[model samples]
Target: MKTPATPPNEAERLLSLRQSGLLEFDNRQPYDRLTRLAKRLFNVSVAMVNLIDERTQIAKSVDGAVPAVLPRSVSFCGHTILQPEPLVVNDARDDSRFVDNPLVAHENGVRFYAGIPLRLPDGAVVGSFCVVDQTPRDFSAQDLAALSDLAALAEDEFAASCAATTDELTGLINRRGFNQFAAFALSGARRRAEPLTLAWMDLDRFKQINDRFGHSEGDEALKAMANLLRSAFRETDLLVRYGGDEFAVLFADTDEQGAWIAMQYLTEQVAKFNQTGSHPWTLTFSWGICEFDHHHGDLEQWLKEADRKMFSMKQKNSAAR
Candidate 1:
């Protein structure tokens, strides 16, 4: 098997594999549509949208009366996956890549193969949505282009599933799906006695924006902030919109001072945004942040401290302005 661009954490390998199966494949989802489309377009006996994990090749969607999770070597997809592009085999028996493979020699007889290697948004060559036929066949330019279009649709579905687990509003880690992840991060932090932050955030004067500018304008401002937050933070950090204008940013492997650097950068950007356009009204927010403390018992204490700090900032700003 080819090595992952990001080294797989073997400790988390099982967890990652389980989640991949859960996230990528749903018989009722767009993947099912792609498999059906593949079968029709190629006129193949078998077509599937698959993801290749370390040990198993899972069919996210399969058509033409086959079950999921075929062995990786039995799959022609294994060879198609090694490089970073599409692999088109007019005749699998003639192609050196699959000439000696069991899928071709045995009664299963995978004579024709074509695969467009699915690249994850992170650039990992995961697997492909491919069509395999028992008879040798060649694809026209139109067929190849149609396959490309269907793969693009599959990519969109994959991205949406991943984005669902995180917060879209504040660009933070969402609570809805992050409980297990939080437990894992917390365990590692406690073991090493490293700093782990779970700071909750609430936008100051957020309600005022809606009250003053109308709700649509308020949504635009929130989305604007969300964009900036996503751009500014490290990929490892979790940013979530807890609810309404409330948010929580978790900074891993950082001290109070390091977080302050990120926080200051965020504050500066928000200040710059406030200066844009001459609409006669501007926007700003109060932020709350705190370091995770094992001595304080649980995550709630950390949130309370962060919330208090944010409320204090808002109060001081209110008095001065």
Candidate 2:
């Protein structure tokens, strides 16, 4: 069996893929529609929209009974992203590259494959839009053109998904993005029996900054808060600008004590920022942490528990002031 070679601009490609926000959100309706269309148009047994990250090939939309995720090394889409043109395998059994591949060697497995690299506007190839069949078949020029057209639509949907999920001011995921991402994150955490913590935070006296220092300064403060969160959290953690001065972080694989330690570091970062005296006002926030309970409730309830704690802290701080 042969494995796909990593792209020369692999780091940049992965960064672009992450920035596209396709992996974070669970809204696959747009991509699903495209895959459905592709399956019918090409008369293929399987059609899928996949995103290749550092280690896994994620199926954002699939029309077949294939696994939602697969290792990048074994994914045909991994090879598809290597080129600008479509990868057409007329017969995998006859091809040396995939003759011994598990997908090809198994009964009723992949015999035909056609995939187009899904590129972002910046020209980084993120993944592939592919169609697979159990029987070998020749691909015509017309077939290739149609597939390309469908892939184009998929790219458009990718851009749209990013815009919808991302906050314009801070580049963090918004509330909608949180809802989609948190659901999946929680599910995975539960299945793996890993500790997952949620931190709900609000900037202290944020409105005062806007009123006294002007809204521009308020924007700057918000951006600084976002930057602080980015610097403090891991890439695997989900950081969100819940709206206005409220922000959130899902500490993946972290319990309440672990989250508290992270928050302590964040508090120090905020203190250091204030010491710089670069701005008229200082950055301070009140936050509350809650560990997820698998048997308890859904994402909404978890969020509410965290928010309630945060609000309680904010009130105590206000009373102290």
Candidate 3:
């Protein structure tokens, strides 16, 4: 089996995909609903919305029995993203590229495949809205047209999801988006029996910065902090502009020690930023982290605890001042 080569502009493609901020979140209702519709309309055993990460293809939404992930080396979607056009493999066994592929050789082999590229707003093909079947079949022009239409619908859903959840000023996840996505993140963590950490952060003396430097400078400060957080944390973590001067980070599958280490890393990054003397004012923040145990009850309770811890730390810092 011949593995597909990476795209020449893979760096830009991955960058655009990351900019969408969809990778940090879980299976959303919009994508799932569309996949379900595609499965029914195409009469396929599997319909999925996939996102191609550097090493894996994540099935962000699926309406069939396929695994949620597959290695990039063997992923049909990987080859599909190389071009703007749909990839139709009528029979994998007849194709040299996939004839000996494990997925093709398995008992539940993939004989029919149709993958329409799911492009971002910038026309970067991140993955595919694809359908698969065990039986070899031919696709008509009408089938391709219908599949393209469904893929377009998936792209529309992505744009809408981003618009609704993204912060206009900072490009971070907004409160509305965080609430929706975090719930899914927590549920997934619980199912996997992994520790999850939530941190509440507030900019120190942010109102003073705004009052002294004007709202424009204050906006820059917020953007600067958002950039720092983005760089410091794992891409999988959910970073949010929770409110004016406030932010939240959800660190999935992290324990308390891991949370502290991340906080320390952020602190070091902030110090380095201050040393640069680029900004008119130094940026500092107070943060509180709570690792969610099953005992934490619900998200509401976990948030409150984190908030309280943050305030307590803020008070101590104030006392030291």
TM-score of each: 0.50, 0.57, 0.56
Q: What lDDT score belongs to each candidate, Candidate 1 first?
A: 0.70, 0.90, 0.88
Worst 10 residues of 3 by lDDT: 18-27
Overall local distance difference test of candidate 1:
0.70
By TM-score, the candidates rank as 2, 3, 1
Tell me, by lDDT, which candidate is best. Answer: 2
Model 2, residue 127: distance off in Å is 0.6
Clashes (candidate 2):
0
List the candidate numbers ranked by lDDT, top first: 2, 3, 1
Clash totals in order: 6, 0, 0
Task: After superposing candidate 1 on the true structure, give the runs of residues whose Cα lies further than 4 Å from its correct spot.
Answer: 1-28, 166-176, 179-321
Cα lDDT tens digits, model 2, 61-144, are: 999989989999888998999988899999999999999988889998899999999988778999899999999999999999
> How many angstroms is residue 313 displaced in model 2 relative to the true structure, after the best TM-score fit?
16
Candidate 3 clashing pairs? Answer: none
